[model samples]
Target: MKQSSAKQYAFSDAEYEELRRIIEQSVGIALASGKRDLVYGRVSRRVRALGLSSFAEYLARLRKGDQAELEELVNAMTTNVTQFFRESHHFDYLRETFLPEMVQRHQRDRVIRIWSAGCSSGEEPYSIAVVMAEFLDAHPGWRAEIWATDVDGAILRQAEEGVYPMESLKDVSQERLRRFFLRGKGVNEGKVRVGKSLREIVQFQRVNLIQPWRIRQSFDAVFCRNVIIYFDRAHKKQVVEGFADHLAPKGHLFLGHSESLHGLTDRYQLIGKTIYRRRD
Candidate 1:
């Protein structure tokens, strides 16, 4: 414990508060007081990487408006935990409930659009693509498109590449394994690349949720699960309200199981576990 606490640079309370405020203002991520060590460790890496001698010097650089450093700080501090199907039920709903309703609603025009906000490394969107492929197979001639977006440009590149450890697909069935992935060999063993068909349907882009969105088209569904919990109440409401504004009439919205729309917005009505629909 002593060695752990014996950080190389001195971390002061004032520095911590300043960082917390800067993070919240920049990305809308609310860094709680308990996350001091997390911030210190991540920020310290930046200081060292830049060859700065102290935390004060790093803070001085940040205050002087180093936009590139700011991006690096946020990227280092942000968490990007994901899996092929972290919440199995949401995908189940997409397959069993949402698509059927959408199919009937758009019988005349069969173009389906989906948005996977904060899609870290592309798992959620790839999972959605699998469901979409199956759906289109069942109902022929239907076209679907998905937009996978995240704030971290680094992770966005990973998502665009469509690679993952073979273990990441444990929840996936053998049939899906054959249909949606190409196994790596020799030097690349133990890794898998997402199939060409799945990659074709998704368009990945860098998007910061706190900032204004450039997308003008509405989506049939929005999967933003577990992302907004990092933001404060006001920012949470703002983002949710933005989702409501952009959703199609009675469009489905899927959030993380731990997240809720309660007291945040009244534009949505609960339809399933952590699922909601925008009110007309």
Candidate 2:
């Protein structure tokens, strides 16, 4: 349906409140007031696809506790906007400062682990992989691994496939593009695929930030950029504290340009713009 026709979707105030509660309980996104139209727009297709007549009926079915429907609901509401080397300074810091220090510290172990939480359709992790690949080319002995994860299964699948429209690589340099991606031709024209070397270094998985994480490894850096903005203050603090728990001592946490840890936690210190280091 057209956005202007969103009012025809039959969403009521009561139904909207129930959905807000469901989304917060299931996905940790706190949709504030004035987002009623947005919520209706995102879920209206699902309601129609399921052959439901109204938002009330959809909520009724969702109340039956169907896990699949719950997941679909979360997926519908989740936002996955992302791009390569976004907030370029983060990648620059990774290459110029963080990686060099990590290389020296892990000289004996020769392993570096990074987590790109809420990695969206894969740009962030892929960008990290490209930077790491370049670093590895020079060092020749170090190994790096990136855990790229998101709560949306559909987006996670896309992230794993590692394909993108050619236009998305606009910010990527020509040299780096040639080095890290295979240009598509013929049937796959106007597309690009991450090279084997870059793809091999990153692993994508489905993860919900509000829940207990099963990961056993500590990371040298955690990139949770532009993610926590969807969460409320309490949930945001929970997620940030969780990131700290999974970070190795002095490990860096990169947030979106507008995000900060100030007044949220004492576990990290601001080391740069939107960058925090675990306090020793």
Candidate 3:
């Protein structure tokens, strides 16, 4: 199939296969058969930016082990569609059921840890941070830490920056809007910065879920929402098992609305909508 316009470089089937291989091998995400146009649109820009004339040349450079180009390829292929409070029900559950129980369980230590796996552009972790901050504010002695991670370094930088357009905060309540964000001013008008307190509670890091995870700390809750859909069954199983391994006993795992652990593993029991609890 002709992948791009005549003015732009053509993407051959062989070149697509090579790009697909690199993406799957490096990130455990499988591009479906119909994603040729999408891949071409994202990757062709990279080819042009590097002054390459064709997808064949891009594939050749990749085959010769260009690590930087490989990084760019992964960044280009990875999808990051997220919003603040994307699934409001999950946050409601966290606020009403989970946080109270967690506070009681960790009363002595006064610490709670949550992981936002595949956190894109800081929204998920920031949402978690908002909830945690509300709880901690009410209970003065408690502390909460949120670790947000993703494979794409570029998007992680955006997350670390914690800046977003005003429209992105629409779902966020007026109350939260006033409490958690500072309205941008001057040349920064129409943007919002997450408050210092909320930002302080969340940390962003580059983590490829398919690779070996070096984090040793167990978490009370893990939000890997909407992430595993890109992976095939085997890789999905691997990532879920890894989440189970790192969760504290009876910890909760939240999947995306379209995702599930049915036939994947028995380490967790379904507790709520797209939510699972680690079996004791």
Candidate 4:
């Protein structure tokens, strides 16, 4: 399928600077001095939707707390690209280490709780479901639930549907692909859908990581992966600390390989590379 592009905005240096300041202040996403093109690309659809011709006018309206335009602006700027099993090693670690630890921790209750913060689509959470299901089959009498969330409402809606093109499974193993996915027929022949059983294991919700958040209880594991790299250092620190606070003692925190908690927070003890467990 062809990707869609938003309407382009014609922005000047001053306009770019204004946008950079506003976004950085509101969400802590710092657009560098030379990022005029990126600012234009990201904000153009808001410009077109509001019938504003200049970036200054649109930006001023946004500063006035125009909720409608601000929502669109957030949509444009938030990165939503994701697919199933994008980072396979994380799943491997979950299966080999984290799940085993969780199983032992929850032996009396036999319930494992995992939170996939900023789960772009349904892929990551569903992948977790697949892993948990396989693990449960071996253990007998263990259960797991995955809470997946994203800031974008549209993406959360798509995630709840649990449908995607079959090609999204390219990296997934054939056994998992066959076991968890239902091959679409008729008009949906080229696509696949996650079955209800797997979908039921994962609950999708819309959540803004930057805002105050409360979970039912501390999670056994939190997957706030790749999404944090987009935030500035301050936002990164705040989010990581929040995750650490919500993490159970000895719970695990997984980050993208390129991401590091070094100097950001010291609450988590480094385990394997890119994986950190909350210091008990």
Candidate 5:
């Protein structure tokens, strides 16, 4: 069912400025002028639901710190647009380069720890799991622990279920399709669900990367793709520095293709397409 077009709610100049400040303060994303359409398009539902006619009243309600109001605002601002294997280069690099090097160095443990830091609805992590599962199957003796996390609780819940429409798998390979997913039967035609083996391998949790991440054990790979784009320079630097602190020696950092660590930090060396390695 399509949601009706939201009521036209106008914002005073002061309210608009405050809204911009609130979003930037909370999530570190900068909103410039001409985003008024985006602002109204996103927040109009809030206005309608609250039966409020003005942005000022909505802002006033949010100021009271109503938990639901806060969550709605955050959800409205966050970009949850993601899909399975959206960036194939990162996966290819992982399979061809990163895994080979790790396999050679850590022959004894034969363990792989991968973190999908900004995992949205499980696609990134599930993609990682499928890759690792295939690699391990070919290698004869290896185990992997894949941790998938996001700040949004609602999306995390959807991810835990591991069910998706057929459209979501358009870019996925047939071999991976056969191995990691089950074709829905009965009332589930035209749908696919991740097989238990693949689903069980990924541990999903809610995490805000802006806060101090306390996972003391370092990761062999961290897929924080597309996440840093929303963060301002200082926040990006802080996140990257923190990532360097926790990343294992020689561990890989894979970011969004458009994002860059250039002038941001000297902690990692550029290796492949958008892939960075921890400095030894």
Candidate 6:
């Protein structure tokens, strides 16, 4: 069904379909037809921002290769819904089982690398940093690094700043809140900044998962939770295969609580809740 013709500049089904295709090709997120309203709500601002009259006019500009506008469109379309320690079980498994194994496997190198794909607003990577820091604090004598990437450059900048509202720490314990974050003051009251220790271990990058980027490092664990669920099956396979290529042999891949690889591929084995290890 098409959007109502009653309203001027109604986001028609054809325009929405075109937008969906472009977004999927660009970032692999298969926006649903149900997302028409969402797409319009977010993108109409873009049209108005360009002083354009209609959605058609804005999309025509996109067709003309306005690289900057394309980027902004993607950013606006991308959702950055996240919170600290969101799926707590994953962190539990990481702190208990995965980190120990990583440290043991890399005894000779004394280094561990983890990737936080789709990390938004710094929460996921910062949470991982807390786990890594506590492990290093107890075990000592090792370097652990995390590469956090997202498709949204605007959000990536916010992640790099390492700042968050104090309420985002509800799940964060007092010990961690004190150890890994610095409290804000006066003008900045009600917020906190990720402390130096966690920041030292996390490096931020803007990357489109389906597209190529020059990331030379391999990782022992990849936290791509909740990301691939937006992609179509083929793109999910492509993205997961790409992760497999970059992961160390037998390394772990963590998906969202609701995500799975059952029919996607045979590259991994389900070892725990939402956890898969690359097959040997």
TM-score of each predicted structure versus truth: 0.96, 0.96, 0.97, 0.91, 0.91, 0.97
The predicted structure with the larger TM-score, 2 or 4, is 2
TM-score of 3: 0.97
Residue lDDT tens for model 4, 1-280: 2222453545666666777776766556667666666667668767777787867789789879887666567667777877787778898988898888787778688889899998987788998898899888989888888999887777888899988998888988888878888998999998999988899899887777888886658888899888888888989999999998888889889998789998998899998878998987
Task: Report the Cα lDDT for residue 100, model 5.
Answer: 87
Q: Which RMSD values do the candidates have, in order?
A: 2.2, 2.4, 1.4, 4.4, 3.9, 1.3
Q: Candidate 1: which pairs clash?
A: none
**Clash tally for model 4:** 0
lDDT tens digits, residues 91-110, model 6?
Answer: 99999999888877897888
Q: Give each model's clash number.
A: 0, 0, 0, 0, 0, 0
Every candidate's lDDT: 0.91, 0.91, 0.92, 0.82, 0.85, 0.91
lDDT of 1: 0.91
Give me the displacement of residue 16 in model 6, in angstroms. 1.3
- Candidate 1 TM-score, true structure as reference: 0.96
What's the CA error at residue 228 for candidate 2, in Å? 0.6
Residue runs of model 6 more than 4 Å from their true location after superposition? 5-8
Q: Write the per-residue lDDT of candidate 2 for residues 140-189, one digit (tens) a residue.
A: 87899999999999998998899999999999999988888999999999
Q: Candidates 2 and 5: which is better by TM-score?
A: 2
Question: What local lDDT does model 5 show for residue 81?
Answer: 83
The TM-score of candidate 5 is 0.91
Candidate 4's C-alpha runs over 4 A off are 1-9
